[model samples]
Target chain A: MDLVFFKIALALYLGASAGYLVFLLISSESRASVGFWCAVMGFVAHTLSIMHRAIFSGFFPLATSFDALSAFAWLLVGIFLLVRYHDPSPIFGSIVTPMASVLMIFGWTLVYQVTEPLIPVLRSTWLPVHVTLALAGNGVFAFMAIGGLMYLFQERLIKTKRLGRLHRLLPSLATLDTINRHGLPFGFFLLTLGIITGAFWASSVWGSYWTWDPKETWTLITWFVYAGMIHQRMVLGWRGKRAAVLAIIGFGLVMFSFVGVNALLGGHHAFQGANRFMPPSGL
Target chain B: MEIMVIGLNHSTAPVEIRERITFPGDHDGAVARMIGDVEGVEEAIVLSTCNRAEIVVTTKDVEESRERLIRTIGEIHGQDPSVFRSYLYVRHGADAVRHVFRVAASLDSMVLGEPQILGQVKEGYRRATKARTTGPILNRLMHRAFFTAKRVRTETGVGSAAVSVAYVAVELARKILGELRDKSILLVGAGEMAELAARHLNNQVDRPIVVVNRTYENACILAEELQGLPIRMEQLEQRLVQTDVVITSTGSCDPIIGKAMMKRVMRARRHCPIFLIDIAIPRDVEPDANEIDGVYLYNIDDLQAVVAENIGERRKEALSGERIVSEETEKFMHWTKTLDAAPTIVALKEKLEHIRATELARLNGKFADLDPAQREALESVTRQIINKIAHDPIVFLKRTGAHGKQNLYLDAVQRIFRLNGAADNQNEGEEL
Candidate 1:
């Protein structure tokens, strides 16, 4: 049942993403409206799917890499819909829905079935709290990066004076800048809480508050990058292209810590016994 | 009645000729009433703008009305009929309907997708209505024209882009800054073009316009006029750091704001984006300053280029707008044809009813021996027979009317039924 809902959500998201892509080319209100309603329906199915997984698995769904990625995409779509409700601009939808679809595809294809019960350390109460906060923070960071990319795109077009179709399709530089400004501190705050919770979880499980494991180290590195961005933006007033560039860089570090550390360098945080489900051929 | 339009627009006449024929200050509805008084014209509307002077009317005789209308226009404007006769272009029937739709849609505008023409047409219609010069035909046609214009506006990108230089500057500013409500504008040296652009920006943004000039007295004068602060030329860099948009049109032999100065200002502002519009002939701001990050510089030529590009886009959109106009024109023409067929249909029904009544009267003596109920049954049966016989001809007339060649069908129906005498009497009662 969970798999069915997930497949439905993924298909709807792909349909919505295609609608947004067409909206970018044609710039029609009807296309944007179709994309928005599809996303709304997809989000409903995604919520139901996540709930189904949590209830059936007898644990919080974020115990595996697949669950974490799916939760990240769900949060991204939720935030996007909420923001779109306030702004009503389809340009952001064109950027966000495609990314959400890709994330859902990765979560679906790589791991379709729930593995055996969580390993002993992962069964603690901190499992859901730590992963939820961390994934939520990652979701907001992803949005900030999208805003940053759009800012740079619009800024470059304006600076170069090449007012083409994309130039007209993209939102204003200040709007994209404002998105980064609002996203940066909130994302940083969530990330800080995420790190604090993860530290507590680590201490409870591994008998230490801080571990120099590659995942932990890289997460700290990502945290610091965002912290620095927040400091520059709030204190020094680094905005526009500079802030956008840093936002993209910060999200890069985020993705690297979220995925790369676990895959490339196995540590205490890595799913050691779950290696069978890691490769696509395992399906 | 047939619809006709007799007018001289920017394309048909020189500005001098157009200026000579305008119907100015018709506060008492005198112009519309005068046009309505023309021979054979039943309803009339006079649309007089600087670019065009048009008289739209519904009349029985198109050629006679056209000639009389041209003469009336010359007489009203105090010119001989032969003086500007060659300048007038006349369209009648379906051609006239298409012209009105295109004009309302702004496809026939001096600037292809301009918005002012629609409002002007609405105002003209309102005046004609007040004068009681518009009947059902003119009222319906005007409403259809307004609807077509609205459809063209929303369904196409015809009137979406900014075409003027000042408006283009505002468009570019909004694209960059998102909103200008809190942003400040700086006008350097206070030239006419700079003031015009500043005024355009002032309408959108609620910010004080700072005027900076080489002479303090001149700066003070401009600031007072603009209701803003006046600053000396020495404080240009300080103001540049504070202002989000700077419009410079100074008469300087060399650059007033250079790349180095702009770099310092950008740093002082912590890299907040700024837009610089230089309309000066010799260029008040150095072109190299555009290379700096977050600094968007557009000169007069660049602004004109953007305007030209937007105009090109509107022209492309106008192609779709023309399609909409043609489609609506066809629909409106169909409706008018049905309107033309209405009288003939009514006359045919009346003709059949007359025959049914006369045949029943002739057989009344034969039915006198029957009871009241039997007599009523006989009358109902005869009426049903006549209606069944008339149905096919009535449908044929309406179908052929909407498909064009309405006059031929209408004439054939009238001649076969010998209903022309009845139709002429019905026409008088149909007039408003």
Candidate 2:
């Protein structure tokens, strides 16, 4: 039933992505509304799916890679909807829905039965709190990266004076810069809290306060990147294109920490244990 | 009645000729009323702008009205008819309607997609309304013209882009800064184009403008005229820190603001974005300054290039606007066709006949006990009454149609009888 709801959410998100893609081309208000409502519906179904998974698993459902990715996408969409409610610009939707849809697709492809009981190490109260904070922080950083990309696009168009249609369609550079300015410190703050909580959970479970695990090291690296960006932005007033580029680079670090660390380096948080639920030698 | 537009615009007349026949201020209404009093003209609206002078009217005889209108306009302005007659262009009927729509949409403007013409036309229509010179036909036509103009404005990018260098600078500022309400603007030196751009920016932002020049006295003079503060050129780098937009048009031999100085200024400004518009021939700001992180330097040529590109975009958008105007003109003409006596008279008869047949059929049961002769007499008497009731209106419509006053009577009959149904209601709303 959780899988069914997840698939429905995925389909709705795909529909929203398609709608937003069309909106980017023609820029019709009705098309944006279609995309917005699709995203709203997708968000609803995704919430139900997440709730169903939590109730069935008897814990917060971030044990598997699929659960973690789906939650990340859900948080991103939620943040997007909240921002859209205030700004009401469809341009962000054109960037956001496709990203969320891709995340949903990645999660859907890795879907597997969660018949095995929760792992001994994962069954802890701090599991939900740490993962939720980290994923929420990632979601915010993703939005900042989107804003950065838009800023560079708008800035280039302005600098080159080839304003064509997209220049008129996108938000101004200042607005995009503001997005980065506000998102940086908040995302960095959340990541800091997430790392601290993970340390506390690790101390309680593994009898150690710190570990040189690959995920831990990568998270620290990503945290340091955002930390530097925030310092530059606030102290030196590094903004506009420079700030946008740093934001994108910082999010790149975040992606590597969130996915690459666990996939490539066999860390303590690696999904190899969760992949045992997969059927052996089957399609 | 036939609608006609007789006008001389920039294309057909020189400024001298246009100036000679312009009816300024209070003279517009008087001129319109005078034209309304002409022998064949039933309604009149005189639109006199700097670029064009036109008389829009409804009349019985197009040729007689046009000839008398030309002579009367010349007489009002104390110019000979022969002096300006060759410059005037006339359009009648559907062509006249299309011309009004095109003018309102700014497609027929000297600068394509210029916005002032619509407001000018609206003011002319308002004056004609105040003078009580415009009747139902002209009123409806003016309203439809305003609607077409609005559709063209919202549906196309015809007037969205800036065409002048000064306005393009303002537009680019808005694009980069998002809002200019609090952004400070600096004037580096005194020049006509620089002052024009500054004044344009001054209207949008609330911040007081600052003027700096090599000659402090000139800066003070220009600043006083623009209602701003004057500063010495020695403080150029200091002022650059606080300025969000700078318009420099100095007659300097070399760059006034160099990349090195601009880089220091950017550091002092904490890398906040700044726009520099150099309208000078030799360029007051170094071209390399544009490479700075937050500096957007647009020289005179660059601004001109942007203006050229925008004008081209507007022209392309004007094609779509023209399509809207022609489509609306066709729709308006179709509605006018419904006002013709032939259709209204036929529709009136059909409506009355249908009513009579329905009433007679509804009372058929009551007359069933009577003989066939009684029923036949009932039907004939009802038909006769319907004909008698419809006779006066049908004749009135026909007579007015011949005399070129058919629109008023036909519209009245159509409304009182609701003959045109849903389409008529929709058109009535559109005219309003």
Which pairs, if any, clash in model 2?
none
DockQ of model 2 vs. true complex: 0.41
**Complex DockQ per candidate:** 0.46, 0.41
Q: lDDT (0-100) at residue B241 of candidate 1?
A: 95
Tens-digit per-residue lDDT, A61-152, candidate 2: 77777887888889889999999888887888888888988987876775555634576767778877888888889999999999999999
- What Cα-based lDDT does every candidate model obtain? 0.83, 0.85
Query: Which residue pairs of candidate 1 clash?
Result: none
In candidate 1 the C-alpha lDDT for residue A275 amounts to: 57
List candidate 1 stretches off by more than 4 Å.
A1-5, A48-64, A114-128, A201-208, A268-283, B25-45, B74-79, B128-140, B340-432
Candidate with the greatest TM-score versus the true structure? 2
- Ten residues in a row with the worst lDDT in model 1 chain B? B423-432
